[model samples]
Target chain A: MKTITSTVMLASLFAVSANTSAATLDEVVGKGHVQCGVSQGLPGFSNFDDKGNWSGVDVDICRAIAAAIFNDSEAVKYTPLSSKERFTALQSGEIDVLSRNTTWTATRDTALGLNFAGVNYYDGQGFMVRKDLGVNSALELDGAAICTQTGTTTELNVADYFRSNDMAYTVVAYEKSDEVVAAYDSGRCDVYTTDQSGLYAQRIKLKDVSAHKVLPEVISKEPLGPVVRQGDDQWFNLVKWSLYCMINAEEMGITSQNIKSKMNGKDPAVKRLLGEEGAFGENLGVSPTWCGNIVAQVGNYGESFARHLSVDPLNISRGVNELWSKGGIQYAPPIR
Target chain B: MAKEESAGPPEVTTKPWNDPKVRSIFFQVVLLILVVLAGMYIFGNTADNLERQGIATGFSFFGTTAGFGIITHLIEYNEASSYGRAFAVGLLNTLLVAFCGIIAATILGVVIGISRLSKNWMVSRMAMVYIETFRNIPLLLQIFFWYFAVLRALPQPKNSVNFLDSIFINSRGIYMPSAIYEDGFSLVLWALGIAVVAVVVMTRWAHKRQDQTGQQFHTIYYSIALLIGLPLLAFTVTGFPLSWEIPALKGFNFAGGTVIIPEFVALWLSLSIYTASFIAEIVRAGIQAVSHGQTEAAHALGIKAGPTLQLVILPQALRVIIPPLSSQFLNLTKNSSLATAIAYPELVSVFTGTVLNQTGQAVEIISVTMAVYLSISLGISAMMNWYNAKMALVER
Candidate 1:
């Protein structure tokens, strides 16, 4: 009688644990696609094409997740959300993952119940002004009316920048990025401010790109990346490791075309990651070809960045985005 | 015979509790239970999820240092300030814009409403045009136009336009003379208060006399005299204490004077212009609602058009106007939330967006913001309702 009761108790414990983990993975697999929330229109990061297909550096992250799940990078439904609506949409389960250029801060991670997968871009706040203003440095912007977007860290940075310099400024704020850009172009504001990358993208669309210049001053640190809901550990791991695979793949000198040749490479880390040596895929509840599928399907992080942002007409250099071994900040953990 | 007739109803005798009223009560009870259960279930799920994720669920963050930045504020603030203080600043900024917008809109709305019925064709038509043009466009677009297109286009600080030797305008903002208090300033203030009280008493006396004797009195002229004469007399006795400190163009910007930033100006201008259109319509409708016979009757009694409006038309028109006008006031208060879109540090932008992001207390911040708006809306409507009741006509 005692043995029978103990067996039943053990069975119930396993049953409970099994039920909890089953729900998250089952839901994603059943849906057959991952829902990704992206920025409205930040060029080279996340923007819609003429065919209404979303494409950018951030969009690639979502595609990598899709490849890991459905083995098809195209199985992603993209939803464009504003900064204000992005987190709420995630919390409400409106989107499975958010790959907008969202900054990972301590408060957001702990307080908002979110898990940032990994940093995709290292950015900082910067200012832009017309060349005619003759403002060589940010300090010369004293008493200037600055056009900035609301609901961003840029707003607070404006106050701090002015106060620290013992200067005053009138802030003209708008809600949308387009409006801020338009205001700056119309001569309504003496200066426009945002992330350095955003300023570069916005400047290209200006009527005369050469007329305006982004200032040399970088005001604040903005480490932007993908984020997911906090409760789903399985989903978080899938996302976190998918990003890790990309970074690791680049560090291993594994490109999309070379992934097949490197499958039998002598490197233990590459073997384990590519499912040639270990059962890492089993632990993630995915097929053995998960990492290989992501590389073959979506390419590595460096490849995506080069194809979309760098070495293109935009020609954004990979200053901080390069692999750590190559003197950049991107360092991935060992897959083993 | 009555008992026998009553016994006929015994075939289907029913108790009060079995009636439709009782059934409705029981149904409502069930619905209430179901709703509570559903709410508790969702709340429980959320709490469990939060626990599993190791996210704290509480309002303790309100006391924590915001550590996030705010761009514009009416009060002193820093990243080290508590979230509570930040919320206070946001609430205050919202009230500041709403109060200014209401007063300015009311003044413009009244003038335009009166002018629309003017004998001069140009005046009425111009007023009509103003109302039509502003009323048709969205307030958000107007705010964007003012903040981005109009204010941004101003000259740089170096080339700011100087007006009246004391005021300056640039992309930065407007600078003008600030009041400077010296010795004996209180005497000037006391004199002004006394002048106002004197005018009020004289106006009351004039009204009483006119009601009793039916005689004409230049009450306006007498009231103006009492209001200005007493203040001037006191100023002469105590020596004028007030002084002005005009703003001067300094190295980079204006110095030694008050500065009104462009954000505040854009928000105030857009809100007033947008709200004035609605108020004008309310005023026109109120005026039109007064029967034509009332105006004709007043004129037949030898009353001029001005008095006919004041003594006969307005009192009745106010009865129709106060309710809708109150709604417009509430709407203006709510519409001020858009101030966030322009970084005016209004309630929604400051508390909901900035503080929430800084503190990571979304649920608490959003709840507080909603409560602030709800209270302001309720307070305005309550005051309006009281005034409406007082102004309503009494009919036999």
Candidate 2:
């Protein structure tokens, strides 16, 4: 009887440890797909089309990571998560990488046991109001009812903005971005505040998009990026370098169309980035042609921006997201 | 008592290992041990994983500043308040909706339930249609219909549908006049208190007098007169000390008066309407459970129809109704959590949704939210149980 009880206890211990012992890359490799957490639908970020295809800058990050690992951009499964559910989903290993439009903050980094891989998009909080409301600026929004998505840094930023101005306002927050837009469009709120890019994204969903205008005021800096669970250094480095590879490729004037011809080119930086020289891919434990795959499949950062945000409906200019050599703030460390 | 000789102890037919009582006890003990072991394993495993993930696990985060604004709060709340205060604000909002919903549902349910059994064919059919239309549809859809389809279709604040220039109904909310009291308000309050006490004493005296002399008193009429007359008299003497602050469109919304946010209105209306349908069926069943003979007997005694229902049938029917009615009340309270979908700022929406995200304390926040709902449900259950026992039939 004693021996039987001991055996049962040992078996149960194994079961407990089995659930918690995931090394994200190995698990992703074993499953043959990268599990990516993204937003429900933010037009230029991570949105699902009617054809069941997801496309955006954030979605491309996950695709880039998958391309680097499996050399197949489509080997990625997406889980659309709300802002309220995103952190828990990542912390519980429900997704290997959260490429949602998540702002990297100090408290989230240290306290939530998560690490920001790198900033994929630089953004700032701003407001959108009805052009008919005759409100030209955010400071004029005193006593205005504001609608925002809940469980975001936007709420805290708006609260601080109003309190410091000694203005009184009411916030009607919703859990989903769609609800916020619906509420704002129905006149439940006088002002809609979110990341400036998000405001533009959501504005397209409005009934009369021409009737609304985004305010000029940029309230706070929002460095949106991908996040991974803490304590997995290998997974963290892989994700970080995957994003850097895209930015580096953009800075080198390398386009997806030219990447095939550049395989035998002579430039040292191009050779190194395209995996012809050095042990960059071997160091990260991926294929030597990993960077080549990412550029060929998902394209460089500039290509993605032009494809998603800088085009027709969004019409966003690359004021700050341009490469560091091109008077914008985007900079990447050189890979030896 | 009859004297009897004590018999010796009964003999055991089999060994203790083969005895049924010993076997049952052994099995129960083993089952208990297994249950405890499983529970401990789950707890330990969760803790281990959480620690490894580096997610903070504690209630200390409650004291941290919440730094968020709520659309509506019964108590004072601001960005400066702690997460604990936010929890209370959410709890109070939930209770406000649940309490108002319970009262509204019960009144509407009792009316519709009786209407279904009315002698008039049209009234009974309409009530049946009402019950079927509402109960058959899902509650969330009803809430969306009311919130998005009905309320959202209303005009904005600038073109609010005004009622007498004192009350404004718009897509934002219903804004009405709020009373601003002067110094002599206390005198009016005292007078109102005295009137209530006098009415209670008069009711008891009337009951006792009727028991002794077999005569009835118009106690309700007297109580109403006292309640209204005393307050009005106090008001006149105090020179009409109350002034009204009517809401006017100041900026984006109406300001300077009591405003009811549309989220609350939408949630309350949907929950009450949905729960009332179920309650109507329960109430109808309860009334039918009372025999037709009881009504006949009351009529045979020359009692009027209203009096028959008030005095004879309802008193007995309540024994059946109260038990199920309590369950409906509990359901309404729990269903209020769905307010999160519509942004009502209730307990689950404000605390569990926002606070959990801000603090990243899912383990602690979720458990606290669950405990709060459990306690609220238990409190409702205990109150209903007490009332049920009081109204229960007493037999000698």
Candidate 3:
């Protein structure tokens, strides 16, 4: 029975790959929906609500791409994936784009045949401990039992941090983010470690949300972004530029509300981005209003981030994710 | 004249196509060829797809460092260990749980099975209730119930329930005093080994004497004395060289003692309880298959109920029990893969879940994992078959 199931799984895997010859863009058009992969449930980063709506920074990236191509932000189908299954789902063509809160790493980019379109959120690995544990800093977490999601760079990052500091710790890894959060919340682990943003997002799920605090130490750089299968330059560029267009729109202070007013503005960059100036969208095999559609539908990067993360429920500030002109490192190339 | 004519029979010739033997063999060969072709096609297409997808493929990733920590490992492993070493650690963890689960399940199953056969209505009904309740539920849900519901209800380390100040139970795990053997521990081990061998030889001699001279020797009493006394004597003579490392609440968790992680406890408990339910039914069926006349015959021969059960009924019931019991064992081992759902770091969780995701070598990792399971199952089946053959009824 095991043999039969594995054979069937492999057969289906091969069958999916047999259509790799069809361009990803063509396939998405034919299917009439962009299949976007996201985390099963990570609030403020691609979470599904009770009303069957998907929203978050990562989810918005996919929506922005859909808006750019189909001129409709709703023309996307979200596939929730666990950390372990995300890459496989993408490689098997189960998803055209993986917009999960996945960290961009060298091993994944080169070895796993994946490409990082661009960083949507700049993050860093951190620890969250119960306030009563009496540990204020990550340094005090020696000999601690840490819970983390499996198949993510957090595992390796935690190992490196503890080893370099000559500390002893134990890891209790779960395949899904919810399981890790549950284990940590149940007091099965002394510390919960992941991206700092994830710590905040998962903190909301705990029974006593105010009783936990994320540590101050940022162990590793985690540039969370969307990913696409390598080798399709056109699809890659479309996803990449979709994110770039949002950042550029935010940089030029052109948001969903003011995009129409600034469509005929004198600034060459603004005019070009708003589809009033050049053939920028045509080069990417999309309509002239590709950038305009993205801004009008999904809003600019700042607007999306503020709507999903920086506002009431999550309240995460745009610390390192703000535009470069605002002293943050988020920089995008000129549209002209 | 009729008898003489009957001496000559008509010559017969048959076509090979019409022959059943030839036809069966020919069809089998064609089937074999088709199967081989299918296997090759699957492999060839997978290779082509892998290349086209630009995913790296090879076994060299095993030698690379696996920078991840494990919660519980029987073998020595650190984050610095290679992926191969991590694989070994995961495999050892799997074997440990399977071995411990089998023992616990068999013991609990036998007790429950016997209880179901008890003359007491309450005892029989309670056993029936347990079997039905556990067997009807899915094993994964039972595992979650144990891990997330039961174990999760335990207190944290600071509020751990201490047993005699030596063992501690908490949400973290059960922490017990681990033995630290110093010099001269080997002498105690040697004494124990010798005692075991002596007891075996003495039991054989006692059996022979009972058969030939109609005399019984107290082998059990002597065996117990030899086994315990010899080891105790060695320990005392060696100046009591063993020390215990007791666990105590330190910064966050208990330190300096052997701790059984909660994941292992949950998995082991769930697997044992779930499998024992099925095994209990199997044992009940085996015991019931033995005829009631055997008990009556033993009673007529002036044997007590205890002796009748030990000598007559059980030995016969085992003949029915051994075959199906092996299947339950295999099921338990395979079901341990569900450990991946929780964080047990078993083969599936560590090697397939983590390693495969990190390396993106799904084909190699999954194939190795499946092969490992297959081998373990085959090994259990072989051992059970040998034991079944030995216990078979020997007829003169």
TM-score of each prediction: 0.87, 0.95, 0.95
- How big an interface RMSD has model 3? 2.5
Model 3 regions more than 4 Å off: A1-12, B1-19
lDDT of 1 at A123: 89
How well does candidate 2 score on lDDT at residue B159?
A: 96
**Interface RMSD, one decimal, each candidate:** 13.0, 8.7, 2.5
CA lDDT, candidate 2, residue B132: 100
TM-score of chain B as predicted in candidate 3: 0.95
For model 1, state the Cα shift of residue B373 in Å. 1.0
- Clashing residue pairs in candidate 3 are none
- Tens-digit lDDT string for candidate 1 (B1-396): 345548787676556676666778899999999999988965566556545555566888778876444555678877668878888888888899999999999989988888887889999999999999999999889987887776656886677889878788886678778888778777767878987887778778888998999876787787778778877887777777667898776645566677777778999999999999888888888899999999999999999998899989989999988998999999898888877666677777767766655555445556566778889999999988999999988987
Top-scoring candidate (DockQ): 3
Provide the lDDT at A124 for model 2.
Answer: 98
lDDT per residue (tens digit) for residues A88-192 in model 3: 778878789999988898888988778999999999999999998888899998789999987888898999999999988889998778889888988889899
Question: Which docking class does model 2 fall in?
Answer: acceptable
TM-scores, chain A, per candidate: 0.91, 0.94, 0.96
Candidate 2 local lDDT, A210-285, one digit each (tens) = 9999999999999999999898888999999999999999999888989988889999999999999999999898
